[model samples]
Target chain A: MKKNIILASTSTVFGQPYLSYLKEELEILFADAKEIIFIPYARPGGISHDDYTAKAAAFFKEIRVAVKGLHNFDDPISALQNCQGIFTGGGNTFLLVKQLHELNILPTLRSVVDNGVPYLGTSAGSNLGGMTMQTTNDMPIVYPPSFETAGWVPFNLNPHYLDPIPGTTHMGETRETRIAEFHTQNSIPVVGLREGSWVRVTDHKIKLGGPLTARIFEQGKQPYELSPGASIEFA
Target chain B: MKKNIILASTSTVFGQPYLSYLKEELEILFADAKEIIFIPYARPGGISHDDYTAKAAAFFKEIRVAVKGLHNFDDPISALQNCQGIFTGGGNTFLLVKQLHELNILPTLRSVVDNGVPYLGTSAGSNLGGMTMQTTNDMPIVYPPSFETAGWVPFNLNPHYLDPIPGTTHMGETRETRIAEFHTQNSIPVVGLREGSWVRVTDHKIKLGGPLTARIFEQGKQPYELSPGASIEFA
Candidate 1:
């Protein structure tokens, strides 16, 4: 089994419907599957598990596929093993990782994802594919046992990445500055996946998707831009 | 033996010298002390400890008070105990908290601040005065042993806080949304300290300082604005 994943920067770009842009790609990726196990642990905007799950289910319903929240299952490990596809929605990364680690099934989740389960992730969900969540932009509302992620992807991710707005007087650090700070103490490469952009991973091939160019940050090196359709297999 | 602290939202505002706006207030706060111990653990922008300390040293030098980096001493705990005043600079909050917890001196540091030793903190440094650093906006470049902070202040602080940029299309969560998400799980109140705004704690009184108003978020309540000079003592 080889990895099959769609790591999206965000579920929706500004003025877009929920997961609307990725609908075609999703239909292709999960073509053979009848249903997906939706992990709503991230709970975007502090939404409840059931509500977040319903949102994903609504999207999949349009594609004629059934959806089930992982929380609905008594055994999450068994759920993953039995599910045709998996979709982790956007939300707070800390909360998601906390639940994952607390369940003590990160290894199981990673193993199944590694074994070629069709997976879809957005925002915080996409961040879970990295080696660690150190590059996340979300607030640490909760403390997790570790910063480690699923490591389904070779490099860490910075989803919903934004370039600094010009002529702004705000003193808050920019996306690039924050990632540079991450590199100061970390050696891993980080992919700055801008809004409307994503990474499509099919076994060994990882291609940048969408209209925007991605930014790649490696320690001690200048960050370079990656155009749409660029291959990040070497990253 | 009551808290006497200055928690600033940022170390420097745009178009101003470092710590310039607060120089007069600082001189008055540290009037009784001949020197202040500087904790450079935050290491803003990934700067080195000594380099960041020197920046603070230069600013304090103008006020005729000596400055010493906590890292310069052979024993950090003893140095802190014997210090006349203490100042912690801003940087990555996770990195700052990680070092403080690893050193196992948060309790000692908190005890002294609660005992009326003059204390100054900016950005990440100020977040340390809260119950936890979970409200911080910085990237979590490193994982700390805990989300706990000194708790010298009753509520958590969100420094360098920014409201949504008017009319822009970026979809990242606003400061208010992030804090609201934090409140979804944690019950602690979070103070959104705008850049250039700060809180001055004198004995039991906590007053909002600087030119701008601050925002306060309590769980299950609408976020309210706090005008300068307003008392957050109830917070």
Candidate 2:
């Protein structure tokens, strides 16, 4: 069987309830699953793993899908192997990647998802599904053993991809500049997923979803936009 | 000799020539030195190290101080040790830190700067003088062996610190939120250095320099601002 996944730019949008923006997408994504196990490792602080997981549960409750935090399980690998569906909420990619590496479960997470377990990821969680976390916008609060991440998707992802505001005088490097810098050292393609945008994968097919056009950055090429439903094909 | 350093928030403010914003400050910092060695590792792309160094050389020329790129040196460590003064121009912090680690010159750098070789740093360069580069705003395009830095000053730095725009729906973490997350994992202090602001150090004395007030974040405490010339005292 082929892998199934939905990697979203963000779990929430401006002035909206948590996960409310993706309500329809979640319902369809989790249609056949009996239960969804959440990995709340992205949000390490500001909220406890159980508390963060509860937030996901509340949302899943709306869709009538039973959900539990992966943190509650003694053996997370085993739990993931037996789960019907999985959701990884967003937070700091560094923290999430570190935890995944420390637990020695990156391989397990990849294998199960490859075994056809449906998966959903938002923001930092979505970054983990990409080639590397090096393009993350998060501060390096902690160091991970490596910049490598799950290669569920062929390209690295810049979640919540923002455009440079026209009138802003801020001297900080814009999202495009940072990713351009990333391209200098890496050959992998990058998708600049705007808010409300997502990458939907069915088996070997990958397509862009949402109202906006996602920006694409590849090594040695100018960034261009891909319209909704456009295929994000890779070799 | 006491450490003599000027760590500016940026090389240039918007609408200003490179390093021109800190002209007066640099004059005082490098007054006694006949020449300044420039570190151009922060800017890894878009410009060559030779070209980046030329920019710095041009700025130093305006002040009538001879400047040379560290890249031209056969031994970066020895050149830094014997240099009358040093200047590290800003670009990407991750690249700067990674190069510093790979070249095995971080310790040599810290020792020389401590031995009282007058030093000037802007943005990524300024971040190198901090406790750690974990607080840097630059994207992690490269992974260094370690996040540790020079510790020329007690606190970490967030260069090009920007205040959130009054109205925006963009959900990317604001500069404040990113630093807040940093506090969740580390106890090191962080100074949000806005454009035109800098940290001045002389011997055991540290003070906030430049026009704007800097936002300071300490562990388990609320972030607050320090006015110009205010002592940045630390134990």
Candidate 3:
């Protein structure tokens, strides 16, 4: 059996309701599953785990899918193992990775995903699917036990990746520059998933989804754009 | 004697030459020092440490102060200890902290600052003087041994701090939201130092310098602004 996954740049694009843009794709992604477990460990704006999970539940409710937060379970590891599908929402990557490491479930999460359990990840969640959390745009509000992540995919991911705004005076490094710095210390390839874009992984194939082009970063090379539907498997 | 420090939000303001905006202030700040060692581990854009140091040296040359890269010394610890003044330029905070911890010189750096050796830091460099690197806006491109920094100042400093661009449709978390999230996880106060703004530390007194007002974030309280020369010691 092949692994199935959808890694999105964000849960919601600008002016859109939560998860609304990805609804149609998500329907097919979770078509066979009646219920999906949600992991709310990232907790945006430091929202409570229950409150964050409730937000996810509300979204999944619209698609007629039952949503239960991983935190609600007696044993999160067991809950993950038995789940048919899992959706991890966006927030602080460090916090999410910290909780996953502290709970000693990174291996379990990877095993289930490898076993063909459908998975959906947005923003920080998508970042975790990569080799490490080092490319995250989120603030390092908390410290994780390790920078290592699920590595469901072979490369690192830079989610919600933005192109440099023209004529902007902000002195902060561009997303491109930040990732280049990442490559300085790491040799892994990085896929810069723009807003409204995603990567769909089916078995060994990974293809870019959504209308925009995704940027690819590799060591000692200029970053280039990949059009939607382009195969990133070779990246 | 009191510790003398200059923690600027950036090396240069937009449209200004590198370190040009701070030149006048830097001259006064380093008036008594003939030479200052530079720490360039945070290499911007993955530039080599030597190259980054050259950029700093060029700027300091105009002020007639001899500059040397910390990496030039055979022993970084001894280089730090024997230096009359030190300047750490900004790039990526994680890399900077990683090198500092790996070299086992964070303690040495802190002790020198506490002992009143002249110090100058901009952006990543400035963030290190804070309680922790929790408030840094830079991406985490590497895993440092620890997030603990010099803690020379009581509160954390958020450099290159930006106000949300009005009427923007971007859904990414604003700078304010990111820091607010930091407050949720940590109890320490965070001062959002905007570009062109800096904090001058003399003994126990910390006063906002430069021409702009800075935003301060404290747990369970509304964020407020502090104008130039405003004391942040009690924040």
In model 2, which regions exceed 4 Å deviation? none
User: By how many angstroms RMSD does model 3 differ from the true structure?
Assistant: 1.1
Off by over 4 Å in 1: none
Lowest summed lDDT across 10 adjacent residues in model 2 chain A is found at: A41-50
List fnat per candidate, in order: 0.86, 0.71, 0.77
Q: DockQ values for all predictions?
A: 0.86, 0.72, 0.83
DockQ of 1: 0.86
Worst 10 residues of 1 chain B by lDDT: B164-173
| lDDT at position B131, candidate 1 | 92
List chain A TM-scores, every candidate, in order.
0.98, 0.97, 0.98
Better of 1 and 2 by DockQ: 1
Candidate 3 regions exceeding 4 Å error are: none
> What is the C-alpha lDDT profile of model 2 across A135-196, one tens digit per residue?
88888988998878888989999999999889877777888999998887789999999999
Minimal lDDT window, size 10, model 1 chain A:
A226-235
